[model samples]
Target: MSSTPGLSTTKQFRNLLLSDQLEFICEAHNGLSAKIVQEAGFKGIWASGLSISAQFGVRDNNEASWTQVLETLEFMSDATTIPILLDGDTGYGNFNNMQRLVRKLEQRKIAAVCIEDKLFPKTNSFIKGDAQPMADMHEFCGKIKAGKDAQSDPNFSIIARVESFICGWGLAEALRRAEAYRQAGADGILIHSALAVPDEILAFKQEWGNRCPVVIVPTKYYATPTDVFRQHNFSIVIWANHLLRSSVTAMQKTARTLKEQEHLLSIEDKVAPVSEIFRLQNAAELQEAEDRYLPRGAEDTCAIVLAASRGSELGELTEHQPKTMVKIQGTPILTHIADAYNAVGIKDIVVVRGYKKETVNLPNLTYVDNDEYAETGELASLLKALQSRKGRAQHTIVSYGDVLFNKYIPQSLCQESDDCVIFIDSNWREQSRYSRLGGFAECSIPNSRRAFNAKVYLKQLGNKIPESNTHGVWMGFLKVSPAAATLITTIITELLAQPGNRKATIPQLLQELLKRQQPIRVLYTVGHWLDINNLEDVVQAGEF
Candidate 1:
């Protein structure tokens, strides 16, 4: 439903290098950290080998295998929208290893890799310092050539990372290695230095003659400004290890404070709110998957909305239209309701239609005609729609056509595992039409240990409505689990057979299910709902 253009992150990364502007990339160890880096406004990500190894509480001396690092990079690629440049430490092995690494990285949509010219199972440069062994010139160049040959995308970069300074080999060796790597078809050169300043890195960029793009990892020389890198014509700058390191410090401090105070309330205000965490974790997206793939009769994901009512009480609003067909802000009210469902990834929709059924057409929807709309209630229309899906769908959300609520309501409903779940508005008295409707039925659920995951049992169902002591009013959204489908169908049949309950309502049907001792629960979502009945209700809903 979105019209925004898609971006090839690989091409965009290559373009950033081709452009004159310097690219400042952030480092991440996992998917969530990568997303955090992106959210902080960085242009690209660096999948640091050290950070990934540290994540598993291991040293960064090839302790974590290449496959483990590759898996981490894959998660980063999927989580963040930007390109990732992986720290391919010593290419994991020989030229053969380098070739396989390139192939795997390209498959995961990684934009680039920076392979250091060090022996296999190399130690961390910053820790080992001055004692690390550099790989043979011919051998390292062969590895670079192999990686370049294995690259699947023309834009995929293979940057040769030179550790001459780290190995105590002079600037001359670093420059020589840079030239050899460039000749060996490496897309760029990353000159690494463990010094407290960028003097050696800046000198390398100057002497290298800009033959290829230059990269710098200023971990030790953190104070070097971006303008200095731009002055030396460095193409990319990686602030590697900051995110993982900062996270550790923050977590440690929080843990210590919690231990000292023996409670979390003191730190609650300082920590990230629960809502932000849910948004970052893509809770809504997860619920969409739950709604689509959970099996009911055949497939678990499906829903039905009863839109057959003519809403005769709305005066001219339904003179020749069904209640759902009436427009709110130039869009059909039913479309708005359907949009809420679609937003949460419920695409298999069934709309029960009667009055002006021809005008209720929408894409990707199945329609069931309720010719008895003038003679039946909403429950009858729902029963007609459920016939086609009797024992199949894993879960079904049945909602009234005359109301509107936030997408979160249905998203929460899909995430719940209850056999039968009902939605309620605890603050329904705020509605403008509350007084006019002469108050709805009260269904109170008490707060007791027995009430937790309680089996709701209705005492009776007829002209006398079931009363609940709970604070909320039913909002007409129900989630029916796969195991309850047959029970619901049988109950509908039995209720229809009884003369006194021949025209049973939705609440009445639910009450009958309760009497049968069904496992039922309630979800209370308060302010975000609209139940349009008359013109006054429409005006109030629009204002809301």
Candidate 2:
């Protein structure tokens, strides 16, 4: 018989019991921990209520609420494809609550839930000792029946957790309650005990025989061998609360060590690295989502604008705002550049601001502050922004804060085939003097009168290009594909490690890529472009 995808986990879980081999279920508190359990070769997950509540620093007395547990289970369900058996404490209330909980769990693709026959707002068994009261057998059985009736998937389990052992009511009462729950439509029975040995569990399992599958959480009796569990005919074994406990211990040790030494060097090797955390968070999937759902004009592309410089040339404008914050016509120059990208649906914009950062505000844009702006150069600001986006963006555009150009230039750069595209104006030498006043664009091209101020394409600075080989002047804009961006970022990282190169310019970094024989594509455009250096250029920008 062919099976549908819906409730496939529930079906798999039911089959696990029928196979006669014990299923090992590990407890997980969050999605990341759930992935760890699956990667460790566990067959299924047991979403322990104690672990879930402790994750939020709350007590395990239903203080975290059923909704909170359901939310955590949803994350576990999304993080792994294995079956998740949730711990439903006292059915979260009564028969009506049990019905809702069953429906929600089934909807979330949970395989099963073990609801104990105890009073509502149940405390952890190991904590309250023998004082915990057990619920009436007939009424608790009705809760199981309601849960079973509400589940649309026949394989979705409602396992009855008997509290008789915890209440010191002995094996006879436990067997009787388990049988009653089985008659009321519980698919399995979870006989719990807080004893340090497995004798009570073994006796219950032996007397119960194969009447139904027996599930046990060997927390207190963790030293018992798997062979012992198998010999007792236990169908499933849960290692509950261990993962969260270990995490707490490791974290506390790290925190205490840091407090004593006041540094991270002592505990660096003992903890997991940030890269591993990134992998656990599935950052690559987030980038893919950005590529899929974000506006496709640039297709997973982003841009970083180096706007930290104060633009000392623009005298009065320097008094209040950063260079990019200077107004061109009625709007800020930064706003103009952002609008150009946003016009073509390029929404992932990161602007590095330093001088008067609070004054350069724009909606729907990310900002990173260059705290060392006064002592460092533009590359330092770029590094700050790029650091925030490492391994998160592939195709990116790097632009200067002072340049204003036709929006079509960026659109054209996006469709190129090469790893990097340098926007240049080949006609800069022939243009009138007013245009040159903006600043002479520079490249490695030697003896080129048009190459003067080295503002853009810093990655191409040190190479000496014959005037004849030079096609145009750098236009303060670049489109870097994934491969070239990675290389450029790597070179920048290496340079920043050197004491003298920490404040290296963008053009200097581009020159490193050029020296390494990285192919640099040039996009020659004669469209109206303005590089605002002084007040005259800002006026020219406003006029043009």
Candidate 3:
């Protein structure tokens, strides 16, 4: 458990759209902030070398005293329950320092950490006119391998952050470094970029989406929409320092008001009341504590799958029926989605009907009519179903209607203990052999705070669901809970506030999560998958 003040700080930032997963890793900021964030329900904590160096009003250098970093890690980890990941700038020294830093961070019980490929006193990459060459790929990989071997827990992730993109090393250098990092047993890679176009980001994801999960910060360049990244399969998009950004803006506003008005109460309208400040996070999630009806048992978990419309995207084959209905060896894709959950013994089916609802009906099924389905994505249909359920289940499963994958929904659903879990394909390896459509859908969860569409959700798995249960999105399958249903409903309704043109896609909805920092459970699916997106897909379906 976290301290009350720390939890409250977590809630406060989350209320302001700062994500708990974004893990505020500051180089110079107070380590106490770590305790604050952990209490706020953040999944992890971060220590940034850049910010830490700036704190002394001195530039960061490769020779940054390791004692300071060690002390920071110790204090932060000792104060929080969540994992603490530190930014070990250039590994504090060399291969030996890298080894020492690994031991030091673990001694503090830090969640995970990273060491960048940069030289001494590395000038800020984001600063114009500032440039530095990255370390040799072989050497960086060796350091990463050393760190990996030092890790005691297999799940304790070690990220290899490549600054080649930001350092103007170009894509070739970045990719080369990324490959080296992955080979070095780096569990993940964060492609540091102070400047990146949408296509470049997509290219990066296309190139290395499957090699290992890639992470990024949208605020790095302040360019590219959330949808573009979603299409590319860039797994982790940690929203960088919005709290500091907002704090700066708010402070300036207050200063201007007081200076101009000649009074501390210069402007009242500019000041947001507490009610308005924490509405999205504390106001809403806290409401769940009161209105949220605690379930009596595990029976509250429900499995849901929304079928995609039959479109010419599949060509003349789907001209009569929907794509989900298009037979796969005489069995519909919707059936596969159902069977995924059926394998787990959960037969309560909730289908969101849109373009040809009557064509996919089954016995004992609950149909959630999405009259706007043709105009919206699977997310809209999910919203309608959540409203229909009125937060009925303690947990729920959600999946796209057109997916063609093998899964064991019940077992998967029972594995996680979060409010939302996304069934990702562990084998969803991308290749140029495919078309230029959406690549593998990467799990770029904003954090465990931002509100997201019902296409993903959480459900407590503490209760027994049996060893035979399989949670998969094969062809189609997903699960969630009553608590998550309510949150998603709120997210959908909030999306309605956005401009009409942008509210139609789930990825667009995901952007909203970036601003909201809602929590989600992203579970990788260890099953086969095929998307029925276009005519070629129909050809691909036959092979499946």
Q: Which candidate has the highest TM-score of all?
A: 2
**1-544 in candidate 1: lDDT tens per residue?**
1111375677767866666878888899999898888888887888999899999899999999899888888888888788888999999999998899889988998998889988889899998778878899999999988988888788898889999999999899999989999999988888999998999998888788779998889999988877898888889889999999999998999999999999988899988999998987889998788657763221345778989978899988898888898888777888888898888878888999998888889778889999888777766888898897865746889987888778887787887777788765657556424411212333435334555566432232233333343344567777888777667877887787777765568877777776677756776656677888888777766665
Model 1 residue 433 lDDT score:
43
lDDT-sorted candidate list, best first: 2, 1, 3
- Once fitted onto the true fold, the runs of candidate 1 whose alpha carbons sit more than 4 angstroms away are 1-5, 293-544
Residue 252 of candidate 3: its Cα lDDT? 84
C-alpha lDDT values of all predictions: 0.80, 0.81, 0.60
Local error of candidate 2 at 322, Å? Answer: 19
Q: Model 1 — TM-score against the truth?
A: 0.57
Model 3 weakest 10-residue run by lDDT:
431-440
> Which structure is stronger by TM-score: 1 or 2?
2
Model 2 misplaced regions, further than 4 Å: 1-7, 292-529, 532-535, 538-544
Candidate 2, residues 1-544, lDDT tens digits: the string is 1222454889878876665787788899999999999888787888999999999999999999899899999998998888888988899999999999999998899999999998988989988658888999999999998998898998998889998999989999999999999999889999999988999999998888999898999888888889998877789988988999999999899989999999889989888999999988889999988767655457567888889878888888878988898888889999999998887667899999888888878999999999788888767887787778878856788888888877787787776657877776767555434232122344444334454433223224323544455445666776887777777777878888888976678767666767788767665567557788777788789876
Task: Write the residue-wise lDDT of candidate 3 on 53-103 in tens digits.
Answer: 554456656345778767766766655655555676677666777777777
Report each candidate's C-alpha RMSD, comma-separated, in the order given.
Answer: 18.7, 11.7, 29.1
**Model 3 compared with the native: what TM-score?**
0.42
